[model samples]
Target: MTRKKGPKIVVIGGGTGLPVILKELHQRNAEITAIVTVADDGGSSGIIRDYVNVVPPGDIRNVMVALSDIAPEFKDIFQYRFRSQDKFLAGHAIGNLIIAALSEMRGGIDPAIRELSEMLQVEGHVYPASAQPLVLHAKFTDGTLLAGEAEITAAHKDIKEVWVGNNPWSENKKPHAVPEALQAIEEADEIILGPGSLFTSILPNLMIEDIGRAVLKAKAEIVYICNIMTQKGETINFTDAEHVRTLNRHLGQNFVDTVLVNTEIVPESYMDFNRYDEVSKQVVHDFKGLREQGARVISDNFLLLRDGGAFHDGQKVVDELMNVCSNPIKKRD
Candidate 1:
């Protein structure tokens, strides 16, 4: 694919952080394609996935809302979760149920999402990392193994490496990337990773054999929007470069061309523990370490203090993303 009206940007990851970036990107009219994680096995997504036997719709549903140009009432209806009093439907979002049904009816998640995208008037394409649901397996430094995304985080052990495999229901038994996702990676002018979990949300998408291989071989400026605050169970005391190192070690190459880092200080006094119980501290910086790993670092005051917690300012990061796209780099070693 060649350049059209705008830059073709492929954003990868799962969790709440993904939609933040996508929402801002939609405003830019950049040709966007989101390759979302399907390895969730927690909360409403886990329950829906188990019973529906389809990929969890929580993350994908949010991504839809981010890029969709529908009315607010429609968005509300789709995102509405059932009350605890609503027995069978309790905790399930209407969109999740709809996605599950569509996936079942359409024979796969790939086609289901494309159908929904058209209906929602989505500004961009959204692809599940795989057709069938992927089971994320984590190997801890303690030599312990966990099979589910929820379990890996709950264990709070140092993650050594992670990989993906098929659920028992999958006939292939080996995970496969949806072809559209691979093609997006191949054709993208810029590929963005994260603003989400290091080991779970982002890595799970990359762990798929074909997606990882495609990203490694692609001629795009691969940027990692490093998380602003350290997650308690994941990156307790990690430097920005440690995050890059972890990513490089996993892919077995220095594929990251640029890393966007937030330099603003989050005052310890400003953080509300009740609101952000999972947050540890701000991720410290190590410019030397990042340079050693071969990524050009772009640091800025990209912080947004909201609801008594810290997060990346989506516009600030996206501005930098567009700049990187303007002058693309392919700094792989």
Candidate 2:
């Protein structure tokens, strides 16, 4: 009998969710590739992108730390942020600054991430959705145009649609997924999206023309790990079906084959509103709606509560993903 190799998984998205899933997949010994969003324009990432003209490193740094097989202390040091009265560096994470510096030294973000990954002894590939920094542009149902991920989400208005492009202030330039990212998606055994901010974190990568096209064409079983809570500005009061609809709408087709939903309820009074203010309520369940969208639904008590917040159980998500890998879904012609 031959030993079967672990599955090749391509995880797309950014924000905190991607790292959580990546860490779990790494522990499962999956061949992982992370496609991080580059449309960030807030906090340490925003500042670094502004000054260095590189893709925001905050998301990439978090992903790197997650896949890194290095010492816990080293990961802490990489994630360290300054709290000095010095206005220049205050609130900037050490890893973000280092990544920015490396971007400059290496002449681009692609090379910089490669260098950092090796240094961190990363267990997988981390590719920015685009080589250059991107601006997220959203057209709200209110017919207002919002630029930048931070601004769009803050608008708190129902979004009609979104796209990735050159920074709004820069000369109009086309942005596409780097070849590595596209290749990863095309060759992947399973592609997972989300558990992250729908518009801001996950969609930015899919907004790239080639990346979206590749995903639609890929032979892999695409799985969307739906969020557990309704996001205030983005997906407020969004049902599980609405989540699938949003992704389908953005991709121009019903591409998702499976959706992993959390069936367990979050205690109404348990969440700390002050800490998780972005969460308005638990994501409403709509099994029939999800199935109607043509997704093979996998519902379970996949909830994990920590620090007064509800999150997907990483281990459970990976278990489902492994199942998807072994018993791949048939592609609709």
Q: Each model's C-alpha lDDT?
A: 0.90, 0.89
TM-score of 1: 0.96
Predicted candidate 2 versus true structure: per-residue lDDT over 1-333, tens digit per residue:
012247778999999998888898888857889999999999999988887788999999999998899999999999999887868789999999999999999988888888888899988889999988898999998898988888887778898889989875455478878899999898888899987999999999999999999999998999999999999889988998999999999998999999999999899888998998888999998999988888989999999999999888899988888888788775532
Q: Which residue pairs in candidate 2 have backbone atoms (N, alpha carbon, C) closer than 3 angstroms, thus clashing?
A: none
**Collision pairs in model 1:** none
Question: Candidate 1, 283: how far from true, in Å?
Answer: 0.3
* C-alpha positional error of residue 172 in candidate 2 after TM-score superposition, expressed in Å: 6.9
Q: TM-score, each model?
A: 0.96, 0.96
